[model samples]
Target chain A: MYPANKYYVKGFVMSSYSERLNEYISMVNNELDRLLPEQRIPQQVVIDAMRYSLLSGGKRIRAVLVLEFCRMCGGDVAAALPIACAVEMLHCYSLIHDDLPCMDDDDLRRGRPSCHIAFGEANALLAGDGLLTLAFETILSSRNLAPEQIVKAAGVLSKAAGYQGMVGGQTVDLQNEGKPISGETLEYIHALKTGALIRAAVQMGCITAKADEGLCSGADEYAEKIGLSFQIIDDILDIVGFAQEMGKPVGSDRNNDKTTFATLYGVDKARQIVKTLNDEAKALLKRFPKANEFIYEFTDSLTSRTC
Target chain B: MYPANKYYVKGFVMSSYSERLNEYISMVNNELDRLLPEQRIPQQVVIDAMRYSLLSGGKRIRAVLVLEFCRMCGGDVAAALPIACAVEMLHCYSLIHDDLPCMDDDDLRRGRPSCHIAFGEANALLAGDGLLTLAFETILSSRNLAPEQIVKAAGVLSKAAGYQGMVGGQTVDLQNEGKPISGETLEYIHALKTGALIRAAVQMGCITAKADEGLCSGADEYAEKIGLSFQIIDDILDIVGFAQEMGKPVGSDRNNDKTTFATLYGVDKARQIVKTLNDEAKALLKRFPKANEFIYEFTDSLTSRTC
Candidate 1:
């Protein structure tokens, strides 16, 4: 999951960048909690089911990426919060459905009972649907953003979550479960399944900032590289990371006979490819002459993570 | 399901309205077909499965309502087509998910295989997810609509599809299944499950026309009453209508021990309630000052049926 002790030493350094990222995550979580209220409903069970998987505690990477990218593009973080919350909501929906008996059929999610396991299968399905609809609601609730910006942002999100992006990726993933997939096909699957949302995150930031089209396209390219690299590293972690450390079952992919980068290409080759992609991602950011420090540090932190 | 012999006379006379409705449905189907291209990909089977359900014949009542309501409110039908298409997409998603093996688990829909039965369980689930995501895509594609109108329409659709609407109704319906339900509870379920989308259709029409809030709200009230009345009449039909007339099994509600209006209030009382609600719906529209012929005819058509 990480490159040896690099993150260990970085953690010991108490860097200002790390502190700021932590602060941003905290704020995003606070906003998310406020937005998804569990106390206002008559059926406490349904609300609890929603909160269970929602608050199970992941890295909050999507939300942070949205906020940090907006900040790096010289946009107000406050204006980006709704989109950030939306990104997480979309992510949560994916996870909820992924854990369904018809899908991944996993009993545990984030070391707790999956939504379907906690609530009934029916409620889990509704909870996921609710969250998906709520994501659009959050984006539409961006009262602070310009109407044009909101439209653009909604477009990005819809494309990412729709047939061409995450759902398409998932469709391909499910179809190719027991079959041997070519390297190219696997890459296409990962690009849609995982890379699309990440790309949208960067584009959302630029659009929210009302950045020029050239810069927006540049950020997209950068996001594309980093997103694929992130997935490749995740594939590697499935093989080497411990279950306790990852908070998810290790080697579940291998057990399911699912296609992964490590399965198609050896670990060393996958690692080398991710490194090359990382370099390309950094190079793409060169077009932004006045890039913020957080951008560089965030990119570095992503490629250098250890679990 | 129309009453026998009644169709022989009225069908010929109402052919013009049916033709207009068919033209509108054809436009929606064409748009959906164009959006979902049939190509051989790994996910083609799942895409086809979703297309099968979508293309299967139905009344397209929601889309027609959107178009007619827009026309009645003095808006271009062309401008409302995207929102109209969106309502169908949302409705299609609900049907696909509702037919899942974990949900309703029906073998047939619209005289064809259900999504799960045609596709595998996983792909069926993903197909539903894909359809839901695509609903937003369809709505967001309304680039011709003004930004404020787009925002308003999106808000209305989202609210109708979310917790306070369809999902909540489904949850309550699931919980109340096979149990004795009060007339009020049944009404509540029908209102949220069916009425919400019906109300949204009228609201979308008014907002797209940039009509005053009073007019929109009045139309929505009109829609809500009719929507509930529609469902109550449906329950009445399920108990008394024949399989040949309805094109599906009848008395399945009693066999399934479902607590529908007829089960809760007796068939005669349910029919009477439908009449009352239809009257109430027509009364609400009196506030519109000048009613179009379509509005009057549509409202009259709802409760006047004798299947």
Candidate 2:
């Protein structure tokens, strides 16, 4: 599950935090659009499918984490921009594959027809494959990073996205559908399914900034807290949030009989857990030498988001 | 359209070239087995699926190209073994995806149930995802190469595997199924779908060897000729090859009403083209200063295979 757009909450007002978030979102969106491959003859549809899902607007939270963490670690945001986009590309690929008929079979994503629905199943499959491969291609294309740094960053990403991480988690999740799973099993699934990539995002930013080992460890711990909280928020939203804001049907988790935090512990307890985890995440951020007020607000804002 | 097992062909006897090729295959298989992820909790099935396809026996020609080119360019074979396995991992992933029901819908691979048929569509899909991501992880995990060389080799691989290459060619191949297509389009498809990775295998080898640009270019030219001939041979095999030796059913291309070199140019003419192209490829190899007698014999052996 990913964070949704909260800019249009009923009583929300644009603050400096909102403005900076918007700026980061715009920068990432522009770069993603610029980096998308041109539609060459005979293979234009595959490229079109890739662009359609990639450019479809979301909050760009994963990408923002990469840039904001880099900035927090005293790294050049421009230098980390490609890495930021790479994570987003990888995330988009997961979403596409997760929506396939043989998988979750979802008909929509971010309030639009899913990749398989918009493009036929075959092209959609290839689109996911393309995006996954392109994620690595994008990372290696970064001109500002040293080759060592690039290799390290790619290793982090590939581990997060590979069999031991996201794909492995998805396999378990699908296999357990409609079965009674324990709390520990659920946690393991979420930790690998989503937590791994979030941790990689923070760690990659630190590596790009040449942060110390201790700082990387601290950052990873912070990422773990926020990533879990993010998932809890997602479960809560599925039960109580608006479809218009959430960009997908509400209560689909319950409809599918999925065992989420809300289903296991109830929404109130899940909210409590999110608050505690996010607070700890923000507190952990304070240990970083270059952490700033904007970073604090950004970390806290996810806890209060309705969408 | 990979090269089939030729060592077991009637009247074929083990020679120095075969012995060395077998040695390379055994090394790659051992390394791949060692590198495969342990069967972790709740995710064991995905790993099983990944291993099932990857360890299925093939000639390992693409991987051999990586190692042989590295050797031909005077590089350490041990240092490049991981790269060789990386290309093999990538090839296996592509085959898994290509056999999916939403794609080519084949029910068999390497004389067994295809990945989707063996593991179910969803797990097979994740298995392919796992292998593709693992390919990059395997490359970066190498400790023998310089960081720059690793980065360069990874870049070559990602480009060959991504939208502009393998995936793009697959898209066109699927779109043109059961339809009339020109020779130019057929060439375009084969060049990207198969040739790109073959070219990358050679290029990555040269990069690992620190070969000069002149030698890299010549290696690439040789790879191109052999790669094209490889496809033409595949088409020829589809028409005349034995199912027992070819592993999958022969003439399935015709069964599926697919356009192929044999269909477009006739088997005799396709064979003639293969002979001419392979001769040119072998002659080009003679230009590499360290190219050995075994390398030439190996190249020629492919042209005369019956499987």
Candidate 3:
């Protein structure tokens, strides 16, 4: 029923998506590298550890979401770049801490040694702390946003990073480890852990663009749906995708006894669920009929990926 | 020659000092209790862990520094209370993490079991992360400071907390564990690990007050000298003071093979160094001739404390 090989279109069209995504990702990597201090006494290793994971290949999807959402809402992409960068920094920190020996104990991240493995456990812990603090510093230092906007954006970011959001989700996840996971429990974890920051990314863009409350709320709702959908799809791909395709070991989750949407609902059912979420997200865009091409293309590309 | 009964007199004066410090401590404790979220999760132990150390209580010297510096610079102490509270929050986080199993691995903090001991290791780690993030949130949410002030304060705080500062110092300390002491190395650790945040606390006060550059610079210099002096005295006290007087175990530095001012300079030399630093810090107050009673009293009190 799906459009087979839609993403297989040759050179020119595929290059457009690849080029745009790569360009933005490059900008983010450059900005992050530039912002972090190069020479600090006695512990350059900590910074290097942070940069290792931060610069190690990711799609930079969160940043792309920020940039596209801002542009769609008639905001300047340049103005949203700091928030975009900050989102990724926060995400990288979560990954670093989650991979620690006392946490998930994963030695590999993005197909290489995790922060703790590279820099030792203490440094890894500090690197996570450093990155998380730097994320706030990045947002606070944004000259593009108004002071009020900065404060509001900071509030959004902190709430997403803190107890009511990602950390709380991790706590719950850790508690539920090796336990029988219910569908509701899975939704709660994904909603807070992954969805909170995604929602914040869109909201930050809208706030920076000075969009109206209604527009911001609509974008937030859209982000929330797509965020969960993205994670569900990721879970499915982890099961079905090969190690080479996913760039990491498969069935790792099964070994970890982690419950995922694919485990709970089966592959076909999960795919249908993502379709429903994608449709709902697109429905929210009706308010912004003049939305930029980036938003439409990015949102469309979400579930279209094979891995 | 030193006064024959000076130690006794100092002890008597310290009792009064303790009472006053306790009053401020109670105020901060109340503010902190109100600020932290009540435990709703099954992890009441996590909240208990955070509260145990938070309420176990120290001198609250950092918060006092923030408050007194603001007061000395002509800002309302009440207005600066949130950031004052924040400094303590950040300090508490550092202490908790420092005592973690993989870190300092201490069982006692302020005469009670460390957070990790009271609440599992994972919970202690989370508590530290929560407190650190909460510190930034508190400063960002400060209603009294202007947006510029908030941003600037956040920058100062982040720099103090980042790789160039506390985290860097911590990484070095960890790497140097069970290693020999060096004067220069100890100096570097003290400056970043403790001195950075203390300097930031004073700077934060000046920023909030919108104090002039000369006044701010003067206060910063004073804070820097006193911060180092405080650490030196702490090292000295660790050697000389009783466990009950000091609140935590003494000889922790020696036991850990950590180089400290006392170990490097000996008791008499360390004492002399603190005196010199205290005098230098006091001399900076000449620039602020109209400084408040609290500033004079606070600086004077730092040198005379038994713990």
Candidate 4:
């Protein structure tokens, strides 16, 4: 929107960004596979549904954020690995539930049939519940973190994922579906729906590294800006992106009559917001000399076009 | 199938037992109300759904178990109250999910409209998920318990409530619906679907007390016996008890063509099993002299006639 008459501006992603993302994504996938229960006899169907949905291909963005932040803070990632995986598992659970017929009614996700489509609604529901429970259990099983840290992490994740966070946001989103909500309302929804977990990811990075309060507070502000920016970009992508690149079909939000950031602010203004957010996030990253490069590239990579 | 020609036997409930339960229920209800989220604006719909299902009238058996077990071990209940509430929250969440259309397809629970029926499917689903998250959140928020105890409680509750326990059992039940299953399989399903959480409640009680390993193991065995016994009695009640007394329609198990203890073992034998398990539970209870009277009355109360 800021680039004159261009409706969608595709930022050129650095080749090195792709390389880092792929390597980190691979690492996350391996750890996820190692941590998840094996699909075996007696509970095969349930475990299969769990593994299928959890191990399903994705960007591993949340896990990467946790790991990257910890690394930036000069902490060993092995200490934060389970926490990283926990966030991903929690995110996956939300995705499964959001795809349910009663929720968003989507059949496709990440270029494949959604969990409910593959496992049937009942099993899909259980799989979501299972994955969510496993996230907390996985966090508890983290060997490196002290019990106090584990308690803090679990408390943060649950609060972010619970009714006051993701689920709370989903409720508002559902209730407001087909109705025109105020721009403020839309922001509130997005903040809770997506922002809470994102903020928690950054906080966990601080928690694992036992970082200073200053860094933690800085991370909070950075997360909020980036989180809103990310959702806005997602809204923009839903309008202008390809179905193949996005996994699900395009324009479902428009079809559902959802009041989105793009709908309220216009595509151009939304993109402008995204640019502002990216700059602000980069500005915050600048404070941590070591975190600057990777954080900038990692965040910058999200808003850029995939196809 | 049992002693002489008694195909089924219903024990007479003591007035004294009812008095004790009523007092305990009142106390637990107050704690639950204290613990649950208030009906607040901005996300009132979701919070309302949560409060509705959680505060819906029911026997506070799970909560009482946690409280009583702590008391039996001579610990201050103030330290265990949040944990008591946590287990109840977990139980309530399971009930909500189990009643979903794709799962049990229930439209009624506890003599009232089921969560989905009352709150709509999407909200009900979120309510269930919210409650599950809250269970852990509630545990972490325990002010009196140490961080380590909180960690241990969260671990036990999540494992018991997760895929390997309740969710896993529900999966098996759904897969085997209307199909023949072995007695061993039925036992496995009940143990996970119901027994797991039951065990957790008792274990949390022991954890809160900081009990010795011997007492913990004893609690485990006692929980196992009473848990199975309780489910067997529930199966019996579903066949012989009135719908009004039970709060929901009966024979749905039969209508659904699902196999139960009664279906496989015969009513008299099921009753016989209940008696045996009750004896075993009591035998274990006797070892903890301080826990004897309350534990006996509570477990016995569950199996006896209520109306």
Q: After superposition, how far is residue A219 of candidate 3 from its true place, in Å?
A: 1.3
By lDDT, the better pick of 2 and 4 is 2
Residue A252 displacement (Å), model 3: 2.1
Better of 2 and 3 by DockQ: 2
All candidates: DockQ: 0.55, 0.83, 0.52, 0.70
| TM-score quality measure for candidate 2 | 0.94
Models sorted by lDDT, best on top: 2, 4, 3, 1
Stretches > 4 Å off in candidate 3: A1-15, A305-307, B1-23, B42-45
Alpha carbon lDDT of residue A281, candidate 2?
A: 92
lDDT by residue for model 2 over B203-238, one digit each (tens)? 998988999988899999999999899998988899
Docking class of 3: medium
CAPRI tier of model 1: medium
lDDT of 1 by residue, A169-236 (tens): 88888778888999888898989989999998889978777888888888999999999999988888
lDDT, residue B254, candidate 3: 85
Expressed as tens digits, the lDDT of each residue in A147-258 for candidate 4 is: 8888998899999999889998999888899999998889889899999999998889778878778788888899999889889988988888788878999998999888
Pairs in clash, predicted candidate 1 = A2-A306
**Model 2: pairs clashing at backbone N, Cα or C within 3 Å:** none
TM-score of each: 0.92, 0.94, 0.91, 0.93
Question: What's chain A's TM-score in each predicted model?
Answer: 0.91, 0.93, 0.91, 0.92
